[model samples]
Target: MDVLRYVAFATDASGGNPAGVVLDASGADEAAMLAVAAEVGYSETAFAVPRPDGGLDVRYFSPLAEVSFCGHATIATAVAHAREHGPGARDFHTRAGLVRVGTSVGADGVITAELVSVPPRSVPPAPDDLPELLAALRWSADELDPALPPRIAYAGAWHPVIAASTRQRLAALDYDMAALGDLMRRRDWTTVDLVWRESETVFHARNPFPPGGVVEDPATGAAAGAFGGYLRELGLVALPAELTIHQGDDMGRPSVLTVGIPADPAEGISVRGAAVPIPD
Candidate 1:
């Protein structure tokens, strides 16, 4: 199988999060996929096998292990499929659930893909999980934004949503990798979403993905989806809001993620972005 490289959430290859996409993985087994993911060395790699029912059976793997779903990888895979087949709506059956993705060409002929996440939910982290989590990140209780209280949000994968009161606090991310990784493994969290709200409709984000063996994710679509749900669940945003999330600037791989949060709580969140091919 050809492993294609694509960077999602950026118009150019220099930005966004890089992901490996395997258009055809029908013959490969779990071990082979894991090996490929490790070789790719990205935050996650997506393997897609076309189904007879017209959908694709997709799986996401990090360097270390497989995950239920991944947002950036899904976006990359959708763009790759669109470039090869055509741009339109497609269904993906993942370990998490069914994810519906749609691709469209813009006036500039750039292809942008949007993925609707599975129904999302958020809840307070277990009492025992919060203190340890904060300690690992070296963040104090007062440093957190009281308005956007902490919660563990899930769209496809689980992420702990922690909002910082100041942008500087969000940018200064020096967490204990080993401690965070162990906590994430025990809690089944894919990443830690550290965010700072710029306005009612704009935000800045940084993701620590120690569990995936990734120091940081330049852009995280899954966490964006979960963050949207977190805002909606906590009544933090007005209904039918559009949020722009800026991430990876400190890492120098800036990424922009557009999040659409519908009014209905049962509806899935929509995360949209443009992806580009990474030169070989």
Candidate 2:
């Protein structure tokens, strides 16, 4: 039903993570939305139904199942809405919580969207689950970064944050798809946030989204937001910091995501990126 394709977090259409946007899907049922998402076959498809108050009721669906939240799709949808309705602020009521998005056009005619996530929190992963996760990822304990440790972080969605001691380890991403998918489904994880810290403000990330039927996500804004929280919650980074995440380079569709962490621990993290339209 009139699906628009856009790549978020990249100025070029060939970069970033592609997402399907349905600006108006009020008439579609859950099954209909799911069918449409499958047809689009992107990592995620965002369906928006306008509310009477000028807000939107948004839902995200992958080819396989409905997701509580999706960052790149949200960025894509907000940018799409801005291009059609004019750049401004919009509120989205999602299954996870209320998300606030602000869009503006740069002098170069590029539109950037910034989303403030719901209050994020981080918790240590279940002890019993770490072994299975490590086995599925084919990573040894010694390969992990001692600073970041392993934890499940949640902003609008949940992701297990894993840090590699070196960029080389992070880049070697061969994993057991079936085992990871089964574990993710059982644990209800949206993605596995694999990261390598280049500096205090710079990082490289890769998201393995087996549950969504994707080998990897080029750019994952939700995971970035959650990672910001993870860093703040665990005192890994200074407060009121701005971090740059480089992702998808290994896949050749390079993407960049900017995350802003506030001083307040209870506040939501800000994820910002640009989305470009994919021509037909």
TM-scores of all predicted structures: 0.99, 0.99
RMSD to truth, every model: 0.6, 0.5
Instruction: Provide backbone clash counts, one per model.
Output: 0, 0
What is the alpha-carbon lDDT for the whole of candidate 2?
Answer: 0.97
TM-score of 2: 0.99
Q: Model 2 clash tally?
A: 0
**Model 2 residue 27 distance off true place after TM-score fit, in angstroms:** 1.4
Judge candidate 1 at residue 151 and give its lDDT: 96
**Tens digit of lDDT per residue, candidate 1, span 123-153?**
8899999999999999999999998898999
lDDT of 2 by residue, 113-136 (tens): 999999999888898888999999
Report how far residue 185 has shifted in candidate 1, in Å: 0.1
lDDT of the candidates, in the order given: 0.96, 0.97
